[model samples]
Target: MRFVFGKQDLADSARRAEHCFLLTNGLGGFCSQTLTGGAARNDHALLMACTRAPNVRWNIVHRVEEELTRNGAATHLSTQTFAKGSPEEGWQNLCFAQVDGLPRWVYQWQGVQVEKELAMDWEQNTVALRYQLENPGDTPCTLTVTPWLQFVPKGKNLRKTQTFTLRGNRVTAAGLDLTVRTNGQLTPCPLGWQTLYYPCDAPDGRRKTGLTAACLQVVCTVAPGSRQTLDLVFTLEKTAPPAARVLRQADRRCRLWERQGGFRATAARQLAQAGAAFIARRDSTGGKTILAGYPFFEDWGRDTMIALPGCTLSTGRYAEAKSILETFLQYEQDGLMPNLFPEGKTAPMYNTVDAALLFIRDVWLYARYTGDLDFVRRAWPVMERIVAAYRSGTRFGIHMEPDGLIAAGQGLDQVTWMDVRIGEILPTPRHGKPVEINAYWYNALRMLAELAATLELDGRDYAALADRVRESFRAAFWREEAGCLRDVISGTGQDEQIRCNQIWAVAQPFPLLDPGQEARVVATVQRELYTPVGLRTLAPGDPAFHPVYGGPQKERDLAYHQGTVWPFPLGAFYLAYLKVNGHSAAARRQVAHWLTALEPALREGCVGQLPEIYDGENPTASRGCFAQAWSVGELLRVYEALERSVTDFFDHK
Candidate 1:
């Protein structure tokens, strides 16, 4: 399912007046927002929001403009309904607005002349929103505009009921086990919400449900000219029959404080409705493939592989994962998982280094997570074919190394755009012996061998091959000159300047480096490349460093990897650090600190949910795309990894 909104910025003038929706394929509704001339171009605030609530169909109504009606006395014109249309498209205009690129709505309400424009930004793991309300009606409008984020799981769109009890002025789902005490206060809930973390927080946050439906009470009030906001946060659980029931029960709270029960219930409906939305999306794919995120990213081998463990695995979506594998395999023409399916076609791109190898990792894990060997056998041929193609050479020059290593691409393969500063792809030796390609190669072979034997297939030579690569990888990539793994070797020479590429060596599917080397590399990255937000693509000592960011072209290229930081890799580095060092209390604390810094990003109106890239420079500006798929996926994965460690410790002890 998808959340639609407008604008990529926080305070865009157009965003201050628009409407949109987070659409499931079945819910890509359209709307119109009046643009403020000059505000349209420079203020290209694209709307972005993210949700892991299973099976949701979100269609939001954003506040964009004002509607006027003659007063009963026929004396003056004042605001009436904020919504601009009848139920049908031809009959009326859907009061839709694009706050930048985000979708929001000019919601209809029975009140004086009161209106609000809502937007969201990513604060690291949490979601944050900005609300603006205006009252232009006489006698003031008690504009009770409730935010409706919908998540549907089945059938057609059916409206649900909602209720809201009150304590003071603060408003919340009256039945939630959360405490609600409103005193004109605008603050986040202390419900241990850090679970919104990209790295799933294992049993850590999942276990933090509020007291019960009756645990707390609160409300919010917006007087004329005085727009008030309440940062309403809810920790959504996945769809279990039990969870669906609880959410539906919670959704029954219709009015809280001055707002009606329907408003609060409308908000909660988005959470519970996710399951139906999921089903609808699955159906919309016409029984073909389930795209990961809607209205944006389609199912790419890379994005799907990276997101599977967290996006699907964490939620017990094994069937979906297997199907995704089948879908990619069905379309495996030149071998590489298509960089992305072209907007409306089945054609794919084979220019990436990480996707196919990652698929091997996913299949292995799927087998392990479910202990399904038959699934492995079913997938074995697909894997073998892919491996064969990679060993032979395909689109990006990917092939097996004579040294038993894996390699892809050529001069400046830019195999990854992590930090392509100056529009220059780092000479990452697409030919032979890149660290991650081999790590993945090693892992894929080893895992495949183990699976092969489990299914009584020819697994003999594979183990020996994996061992050789694993041993030689440690020999080749380790650079005594720089404590980190060599970023690349010039096919014939050593070009081992420490770079972010080495970070992958630590986190990739295979552990080619011995534990000691892994630890040392982790330490070096933690010290040299790691930042509070993420790791810089290049070390400061490198001439390639370019933290000062600028506009597109000259500026965008300069800031890319030349010196900027990637949040996704940061998640990997953090987990790798935990994995190598073991999860000490201090380590977990560090994890919390590094990730929590992104809290501000969740504040509102950033694309999708998170920023795609960060500045390489010191106050390290977040550069690149906002709401990147992998950025969110990896972060969530890291959180889960850390939490699982703690859980395992407790379980074993």
Candidate 2:
């Protein structure tokens, strides 16, 4: 899908920043900047390289500034925000901005129009930006391209230890090597600590300073009435800059992403390509990993399992999915999956309750889609250990209760995916038998039972355990007065707050709720939690509901699960909607309309991707990560679901 922007869209800083574009290498490195070709965050870079595959990342080049000189008048084609305001009004010269395969920006001034395209190699830590000048007015112009270098670790500010030395076209700063190769005259420029501001980081209560140490200017003269193109290459490696042919090849690599996804619908196709950005290959281990989000967040186990189906299965990347599962299987501790793979040399943290269960469900779905029985048999041993560990009680006091439902968490541990713990306060303290965990628990048991039977193994025990869990789950979580399942049944009390978590009861492949109960749960969720983009975390009627998600760190964390709208949960809502409505034509039509409402977001925010969240009250303004994994994954999953029904309709006819 094409995301087109005009002059008016560029003039507004907030609007321009909201519409960001991302170009990623399969090794967890990426290039991101505003549509106006400006650095919006410290993480917005021309070459954010993965020193270690998918984890140890460093922001190499923050941005590239383009200056065009017409006669004596010079126009800066780059925009930046200082401690004051953006003095460089280059955005006014922007004629159009779009990203079909690569990010392309068109700038017109006097009669000179220059189209700048940014693309990266699919597997290399290299970024290439080509500027082709169309000077129809017959005016000769000198175009200078200078790349701003921010040689520091990702998500960190450049400190006093920062050093930059320029030799010819090569610049080395703090052990990070960057080579600037261009057709134009390269002049080494040693700049020290150029302070850049990040308006996006203020709400999250982070240091907003982006420090750049140096820039290398590539000066070239463009002849009038003729198309003159200049190629600028930035790489972490010592190799020379690639030729213009590699630029076209990079475009092909991007297009191949969409063709491989095999989705005919516009949103699905766009999201499928966007989903490809998160599936990075491990450089050290040679396995696939899923990045949680852009600009921040590394590979996390929970996000990986939650995002696996949409990012891989829906996009028809089954081998990558298998690799991802195997990668996490190697990191499994006790019966729990690692919560996160810490950057650098830190050990993986295993503190989550749902990732392992979600992993089982993902494995079952993977086999069902690919019909890979052998793979299932191979993964069966790991699944068996995960189930046994959970049943006997693993980390964080996770074990099956006498009531047959799983109980977990104690002290300061906030598990079960509502896991936002700020200091001693847990925003959504679901520290006991969370409704969704039990739903996944039941689903996992049922899947294991079925898989065992299919493989001629003992299935009766698992089947009995699943049946017992379902009965206990209904009794413990079903709130008769509320007309919906309770959010969590804990030692403290049953949280009766209407939450999106209960949707899982009817949404899972092996549903636990009865027909009437499922309909009630779906209707309740639709009435209270549904939004055009996603489902609200909490109902508006709740006293704890925080409509806006902003302010300091504590405020943002408190509001995170209070009332923020998460697009991922909408996937479950859609499944529940379809299940209750019996996959009817009317339900499909309504689901299609809801899906259509999210289409404009493809062009509006984080171009070709969806945001992580939106304000509970005003959802039109997207907050949090501009490009989220589960956000894109869940949307793709729902789109695939609707597409399957359409296919079935034709087949029955």
Candidate 3:
């Protein structure tokens, strides 16, 4: 899981793809087929036209939709529904990637030495790659691959002709079949191998092919040990106007590794810089986490805090983390910082127990790592407010019980990103003292104790509070029979059914349980809930554990979070086990072996670029959308921790 300075240099990737001009960062966007509108260039990519369901349903809703764009005019695409799963759901290896440093689980490079792997790096205006591909066969093979490009809005002036430095010939374009069959099956058709073809200066580059946005495919025929360079440029002009979400802005660079798994085209350095600069640039006084996308969320404490270790600590972006803390505390209600601010809202949502607490832990950790207490002092008040809010009663019934355990509850929107229920929280009734939230809460208070002592604040209360919550959590939520913490507390009732989310209590920074309890959780989940694609949401014995991740409308919707296995959660659970168990020589080797499980999906896109979830049945197939932010985020975190463990060994030596 540890990543080294990959020898595969971005600037030197023998096989590579580059855009002529930078594509805008698509965070939040409004889109028509080709053109996109967003808060800024930071909106999500509009590179590819999105086709979700089968088109033949002709509900006008399911009629496959695509938007065409040019500076002058844009085209709308109408295509049939999703690539169906007639035989079964799977992704085909469309091309061999020239990129490197992908998860070791994917892409078993036959001839490429581990040292000769691909490398990726990005600059403000450019992304570079250098990777080695080894062909075992004597015959030269044509490597056909397509980089997945996502397009976001440039403006209504969607159509424009642009050129770039080109090294390879265009591959033939083929219609992407996306039809879904009965039983929630998808893509039964045999994929047509795309013929190589190039685009002419039609108003929009892809207008001739009737594509609104998506990556283009290309091919390279190389002899064994041969390497080729990929280069291209993009031209964009303002068309009619930007769609609603797009804000006027300068060219933006997006750092991709914050999540580490996705349609990554390299954004780590710029993100680090922007985040570092945010504090100096801010008109405000408080610390805040960097906003992933802009305008909607003023600061999402969870994402901000989670990103702290990598975005700030690892990348040398300390000042911004300090500034982020300064900005985040202003929204402290009672004790909690705001989770998210909807558009046009001065107030923010306090829908989470973990985020504010996590902020405190992040701030404390930041101070420790950077040797900065000025940062600690700046963050003290808001952190205090967050601590105080958890103790005092707030909305969603957040409070400290007499038993000393922290308790919060019952709001539907309260679930973390794995949330599936729309309108209201799904009535599946997961509530009261969710395992992970409290673990974060416990960790935060303990961290606050260190911060307080370091800064001469009242250190006693933090330590005392931490102990009390620990004692209370152990007494109330632990499921002696299952040997793991219950998922939640429903009024006086504790949910004893095992759930993946419960792993947090045992696996997080401050697990509530002792080593024995921790071991039980690790063993139980590994035996019952673990799957190749991801961890199951619930153990199969639970009535609610839906084995099939897909079905007709309602079934699919219900299954979204129910029993569907999510790969990201497994990352945390794995690390928690490792941390609790201590690394055995045997464990490190197993870590290497287990990681290979993720490889099949990465190169082939079988579950496609790491899907958000998977079914709980045999095959444990990937489900949900192709890319989910946290799904990748957790993987990155897992790998990061793993890599750190290895580096720690070297450092000690």
Q: Estimate the TM-score of every prediction.
A: 0.62, 0.97, 0.60
Candidate 3: worst-modelled 10 consecutive residues by lDDT: 53-62
TM-score of 3: 0.60
Question: Highest TM-score among the candidates is held by which one?
Answer: 2
Q: List model 3 lDDT by residue over 278-303, tens digit each.
A: 12122233223444321112235566
Clash number for candidate 1: 118
Off by over 4 Å in 3: 1-301, 307-327, 344-347, 411-418, 422-425, 491-494, 551-554, 604-609, 618-621, 646-653
Sort every candidate by TM-score, greatest first.
Answer: 2, 1, 3
Give the range where candidate 2 is weakest over 10 consecutive residues by summed lDDT: 644-653
lDDT of model number 1: 0.47
Q: What are the per-residue Cα lDDT tens digits for candidate 1 across 531-613?
A: 76677777888776777655545555645656677666776798778767667788888876676665544332242244556
Give the TM-score comparing model 2 with the true structure, all chains together. Answer: 0.97
Q: Global CA lDDT of candidate 2, please?
A: 0.84
Order the candidate numbers by lDDT, best to worst.
2, 1, 3
Worst 10 residues of 1 by lDDT: 192-201
Candidate 1's TM-score reads 0.62
Q: Which of the two, 1 or 3, has more lDDT?
A: 1
